[model samples]
Target: MVRTLRTSRASRALRTSCAARPEYDSAPTGGRKSARRRTGTAVGTVLALIAASAAWVVGAAPSADALPNGLALTPPMGWNSWNKFGCNITEQKVESVADYLVSSGLAASGYAYVDIDDCWMAGSRDAAGRLVPDPVKFPDGISGTAAYVHAKGLKLGIYESAGTKTCAGYPGSLGHEQTDANSFASWGVDLLKYDNCNDDGTSAQRRDTTMRDALANNSSGRAILFSLCEWGVDNVWTWGAGVGNMWRTTGDINDSYGSLLSIFHANVKLAQYAGPGGWNDPDMLEVGNGGMSFTEDRSEFSLWAEMAAPLITGNDLPNSSAATASILGNRDVVAVDQDALGKQGVQVSAAGGLDVLAKPLAGGDVSVALFNENSGAATISTTASAVGLPASSSGYSLDNLWSHVKTTTSGAISATVPGHGTVLFRVSTGSATSTGTTHALVGASSGRCLDAYDNETTPGTKIEIWDCNGGANQKVTLTAAGELRLYGGTQCLDATGAATTAGTKVELWNCNGGTNQQWRPNADGTVTGVQSGLCLDVTGGDQPAGNVNGTQLELWNCNGGANQQWRLS
Candidate 1:
């Protein structure tokens, strides 16, 4: 009989927990209200003044607030010293990486944070029960090191475990949330990657939320990006949005091709669970680590970029090889990873050890990756229709993202991918249209069609942009009740809290014909919010594809741009 490996058993653990944040209240200021009243005279003027005041009051308070600092709008890109240096981390080493990130053009390419992973902490807590940097390894202490990193225009990230002792037997933040949070903030820590080792009986929410509240309510007023490194013990992806900006969804990845592919296969299924301010992390990247071939390394980076995963490098940045620098410094690949849409790629079709994945990009394009799992080269092919693109009489245009080459094909895209290698393409169709009675709403600016995030039919599931694959999540129908109903469900697209001003997030809820759910199409290719009379505009005003994603659908005054232009079907 075979025994289960510790890693395999740990991967199977799944549980649940709950936590809450304290409420905050603020009333409108007296001076602003008095100024509005002084200008009121006629009955129409009085009503307008009262309406403006009410709107102001409503806008002043958040309805269902989650994050306090509201940072990490996109998946973070940085360098993590774990897979390479591990417990051998030193302050001088971290400082050198910071310097190299700026000098070697990685920081300029959008890789910012320089994170010092585990073992940088002392063997024990201080007299006040607060964490202390290892004096021997970090001679300048965490504060001085943070100052040095800040001076280089790069943020600093520190690591800790949620239990009494970290994985390396160092003091953790189990029962000293307040003290540790304050200490980190005072030390100028910009981000925290909290692990879950040694957490014997602690609930996921109990352990993680304690730290989240401590950081959010810290006295220093420093906003730290919380990265949950729980190793997927509780299906963290299910409820991580309200807990942290990013959460690890797999076991630790070692510096090998097997480890990389294992983590990728595990985390790829969680695409819909990720969005702006929240991400599904497969753990830190192992790029440029000298374990995999250059081809495999390219495949790894390409897949991560297509998935919109964090681009954290875990290699020795200062002594990087020329080939490694080329892979990490490719601006085009980085663009796909940092796309403003923030949608993760999804597996569209798979068969015979060959898989085809598609990612809907911002500029009306789709990124395709043909991956082969075999040990030898294999031919893989998929048609445009199979990936949700309507057939075009003029055919499809293709761009090899890795090679930066452009070409056109009539029908199916076929390529011979090497063993464990990938062929990535950006595909677009010309003169495309749909004839169905009900149509999927596709953002002309984002190219991503409207989607019910996570494919969940629950009320309050946010409506977001995802790779459009002609699934039920992208289908919607207009009803006689003046409501746009989600296809195959009783829910309508409802604005969160019925908010009227710009930036009100849209979600799916029960169909009640509420004014907030009413939308009408205008002749100028704009969708008007019936209650607010504002155009439904894409957040970033259509700044071309591959710019930034996570720009939510908001209400703005009618402006004729591709962002506000919604192509039905």
Candidate 2:
């Protein structure tokens, strides 16, 4: 079949990424605009594409129940081409970097993925209407490049778009998902970074899901890690794990400190969405990009590592400075990123321009980040209890993640953090209360108890406040996984249907590890729904305490209200 030129209708959908390193597109202003890369001019970019492109057969792809082969159990570490070379990538360039990753000691450090972004393909498909690599750039094609990279003991990653044309205006995988997936798998590709560009009117979710299914269903034995690059549209973080190994949760990151910080600040709140087999990618790393000082670069690396992000280096490895090398090789820091527990950190407290972020690691240790975003150095303090240590612990043993020094604190740990810098700590504490021990969730306002309606154990039974009776129903256990369990751990205090509204019903449901079933007990005598960010509250505050019995419980704004406070006693 001969190739042909056709005019794509003007896409009402938005186009977005980086432009000449300028402020072409800023950090995410809204969900859609900030999530896209620079769109190539549609006309000249694709002079000719195969007129017989594969049909968009959604049914022929993999089953929704099927998953990509088991890989990226932890966030993947590696180097990428788009951030540094963009469309200037050549097979030799990738091969050279792959060699550097091995010789430079990055491979042993677990930085092994070498990915090529868009523009690797020729303008026209091959005789079979399959995508082809540029002969000039790779006389041997993608399979050759993959073999070269694999020979270096490193994995290979390829890029494509869910749209008709990629950001660079090359043919994408929209209708040819199965063909591209099979081609990539046949090439022995280990990763797929699928972007959303020139998508026309197709929804990001559907497009991304299509590619995910295709990759998962590929007949090749290779387990390709699917990275959905939708720029966090539709809050991809909440459901990205069902489709891909990792999903970009922010706009593209540049070399500047402002860009780094903007992306970081925007993404940190979505930490709960990340875990083993799934991660929130804050785009690629700019560690050796020369836009910011070594301090800022180190801070950037620390924050991303603390959040358990994929450590995909976007710097020129061969020309990296000593500082960049040091930042990348900090084994202790990388350990935090690759923790076995796979829990992403969260911002626990922020005051006076100082923010405290905490990630609970495996083995009862908590990673703490005292981040100073203010102009001058500030003394930041947070107690072990403040960071969600169990009530049984008196203090924690702290280790400096960067300096590798150990210390212990009986109460609060205070440090003077430089402006735009962070003091990272790994705090280990003793075991928490046993799972079977019952605790009364005493309300601050009414001084009453959080009681299940009529002591009912059935699902959907409403929750209400009652007098402190100390009965089996009034006594609930806080499981180590953050679930508040009633009925001897059989039923959980669930937010009805996972609702986040203030007046939504709170009920007893079968114990499941869903996010809505998890609750976070804070140092401020308040309990918040880990998934919804709403405080557990007693319905009416005006009623006198003695008469408050039987008052309905609801999720309300965290206003330090007596009604919204609870003590696990």
Give the lDDT of residue 206 in candidate 1: 75
Query: What global local distance difference test value does model 1 have?
Result: 0.69
| Clash tally, candidates in order | 5, 5
Give the per-residue lDDT digits (tens) of candidate 1, residues 1-569.
Answer: 01122333342222111000111111111111222112211112211211221110001111132355676666789998776776788999999999878766667677889998878987877787778898999999999999999999999999887877776677878888888889999999999998776664757667898999999988898999999987775788887878888888877666668877887889889998877678888877666676776566777888888787888888777766434554576566677677666678899877876989887766667778888877787888988887767778898876655433345688687776767777787789863222123557655444455777666899988776544457787787765554667767478888778888877777888888789998865433467788888777766644432212233566776654545656454
What overall lDDT goes with each candidate model?
0.69, 0.71
TM-score of each: 0.65, 0.65
Candidate 2 lDDT for residue 483: 90
Candidate 2 has its poorest 10 consecutive residues by lDDT at 43-52
RMSD of each: 21.2, 23.6
Task: Return the TM-score for candidate 2, rounded to 2 decimals.
Answer: 0.65
Off by over 4 Å in 1: 1-68, 390-393, 430-569
> In model 2, which residue pairs have backbone atoms overlapping below 3 Å?
16-36, 16-37, 17-36, 17-37, 17-38
Name the regions of candidate 2 deviating beyond 4 angstroms: 1-68, 390-395, 430-569
